[model samples]
Target: EDKLSQEEKQSRANHLMEVQEQISYDLNQEKIGKTFKVLIDKKEGGHFVGRTEFDSVEVDNEVLIDASKFYCRVGDFVQVKISEATEFDLYGEVV
Candidate 1:
C-alpha cells in the first residue's frame, strides 16, 4: 500500500474496471443473433429470466425471454434465439 500513491491506485482500479467492461461487451456482442439452450429460472414482469448452458446460476449472464411468445415454467430448458445483448443481459425469444 505504501509503494503507490492514492491517485495511482485509483487509476489502476479504474483501468481494470474499464477493461472488464470492454471484455464483457465483446463477449455479449458475440452472442447477438445466435441461439443457445437456456434454463428458465424465473419470471420478471413480462419476461422469463433464463440462463444459457454457458451461464452460471450465480455469476454468469442471463437472457430474458419474451414471455408473450411462449409459455414456460421455471427449471424448464428451452432453446432461445438471441436478438439483443448488453454487457450483462440478453434478450431473446424461444426458438
Candidate 2:
C-alpha cells in the first residue's frame, strides 16, 4: 500500500491545477489569428464588449472593440479577428 503526506497531496493537487491551466491556455491559444462573429452585450470606456457564438461551460468568449473606431449597440453582431487569448477572456479587432 502507498500513502501520501498532506504536503505531498497538496503539491500534487497544485501541479494538477497548473496542468489544467496550461491546457486551457493552449486550447485558447489555438483560437488566435482566427475570426468569429461576436454578439455585443456590454460597453465600457471606449470599448464595446461582446460574446461569441461559441460558449462552453458558461464561459463565453469576450470580444472588445474600440468605440472611437467602431459604432455598435447592444444586440448587434460584429465580425472580429482574434488578436489575443487568455485563460478566461479574449481580445480582438473589428474585421
Candidate 3:
C-alpha cells in the first residue's frame, strides 16, 4: 500500500469536502420548482457557492455544490431539482 503524508492526506480530505459541498448545493438547487439557471460564483477555502436567475442577493436561495465530478462547468444548462414553492437547481448525473 502507498503511504500518504499528513499534508497529502489533508489535501485529499479538503478535496473531498469540496466535492460534498458541491453535491449538496446541486441537490438543493434541484428543489427549485421553476426552471432557473445559475453561475458558479467562486470557491473559497473548500466551499463552492453560486447564484441562480431566480435567487436574489439575500432573499432568494442560491446553489451550493460539492463539485465532485468534472463533467459540470460554470455555464452548463442542467436540469435542476424541483419543489413546490422554493427555487432550486441541479445537474443530474448522466447514467
Candidate 4:
C-alpha cells in the first residue's frame, strides 16, 4: 500500500482531531438533536452510558440515556429520544 506523505498525514490527523473535539464538546453540552438505536452498556448514578457504533467509547461519542424516562435493557436495541445532542454524544430518552 502507498504511504501517505507527511503533509497528508498531518492533514488527516488534524481533521480527525477536529471531529473528535467537536464531538466531545457536544456531549458536554447535552444537546441531543437526532435519534439513534443504542444499547445499554452500563449504568451510572443518573446516566445510562453507552456508545454508538459510529462512536468510539473513548475517542468518538457516547449515547446518554436519561435514567428518568428512557427504558432500555442491556444489549437491547431500543429507540432512544435525543433531547440533547453534542458532536460526540447525545442525551436521550427511550421512545
lDDT of 4: 0.72
Where's the lowest-lDDT run of ten residues in candidate 1? 58-67
Provide TM-scores for the models: 0.88, 0.71, 0.36, 0.59
Output the lDDT of residue 92, model 2.
83
Cα lDDT tens digits for candidate 4, 5-94: 989999999999898787678555754556677767888877888866565567656777877766567777767757776556677777
Tens digits of per-residue lDDT, candidate 1, 1-95, equal 39999999999999998999889989998999999999999999999999999889879898998888888999999999999988889998898
| Candidate 4 clash pair list | 23-87, 23-88, 26-86, 31-84, 31-85, 32-84, 32-85, 70-94
Clashes per candidate (backbone, < 3 Å): 0, 0, 15, 8
What C-alpha lDDT, on a 0 to 100 scale, does residue 83 get in candidate 3?
A: 39
Compared with the true structure, model 4 gives a TM-score of: 0.59
Query: 1 or 2, which is superior by lDDT?
Result: 1
Quote the lDDT for 10 in model 3.
Answer: 96
In model 3, the Cα lDDT at residue 63 comes to 55
lDDT of 2 by residue, 13-69 (tens): 999989987887888799899998998887878889888888642465567777888
**In model 3, where is the ten-residue run with the lowest total lDDT?**
86-95
